[model samples]
Target: MSSDLWSFALNVYARPGVEDACLRLQTAGANVCLLLCGLWLEQRAVTCDEQRVSLLRTLTEPWDAEVVQPLRTLRMQWKTRAVDDAVLKGMREQIKSHELEAERALLSRLEGVAQAWARNAAGSTTWLEELAGAAASPNRDALQVLRVAATGT
Candidate 1:
């Protein structure tokens, strides 16, 4: 992985099976940006705790709901219609780009906050599991695939 969260996210997300796994988790209501942040933190050996989790969520929820979600919803709403309408297609593509930028901004924010945290003697592995807590039960295999790719274990 890379030292910076955004670079690490780009690398890990491009790994085989990771995109699909992330999509599954996303559909299951997991925040992919938060999950990516978890991977970055775990890679850095940051200790996982309720306070940190709470802090990250506090920072993320509003941004995700206010910024990313609206753009994603607009894009998704146009998915099929955009296939037949050229103008809608262009607008939808723009929405997709905006959604991506929003996510990137969120990841940057997450990195900024998490950078102050300390790393442990042993690399902590609870990040993804804890971050994905709600989605874990229903998306076990998908989560495992993400874990394996992120940790290479």
Candidate 2:
């Protein structure tokens, strides 16, 4: 897997069923940004522990909640207007671009956070599962789909 977080995220997300699975997990209150980061870390065989998970969450939660989510919400809200108005459509597309950039920035930050934890021989899905947390419990089927997609198992 690529060491670049953004590239890795794109690769993992493009896998069959991954997008839908991510959406499902997101609906269950999982942060898709963190999930993607966790997947990337897993690919790198990084040791996932409580401290690493906490650090990742600390780095991502505020940005995802304040920046990415708002951009995404606005872009989604414009869907109807975009279909009818060309100007609104253009603006919506711009918002989508911004959203993508925001996610890229988040991924970069996550990569930095995991820099020291990389290249370990030991890796597990435990981090991903822990990151998913209890909020994702009800969405186990969706989470499992994501796990399979991430690990190719």
Segments in model 1 whose C-alpha atoms lie over 4 Å from true places? none
lDDT of 2 by residue, 2-40 (tens): 668787778778889889888888888888888888777
Each candidate: what lDDT?
A: 0.89, 0.82
Model 1, 105-151: lDDT tens digits are 99999999999898878868888878987897898888778777877
- Show the lowest summed lDDT stretch of 10 residues, model 2: 144-153
TM-score of each: 0.95, 0.91
Best model number under TM-score: 1
Query: What TM-score, to 2 decimals, does candidate 1 have?
Result: 0.95
Q: Poorest 10 consecutive residues of model 1 by lDDT?
A: 144-153
TM-score (C-alpha) between model 2 and the true structure: 0.91
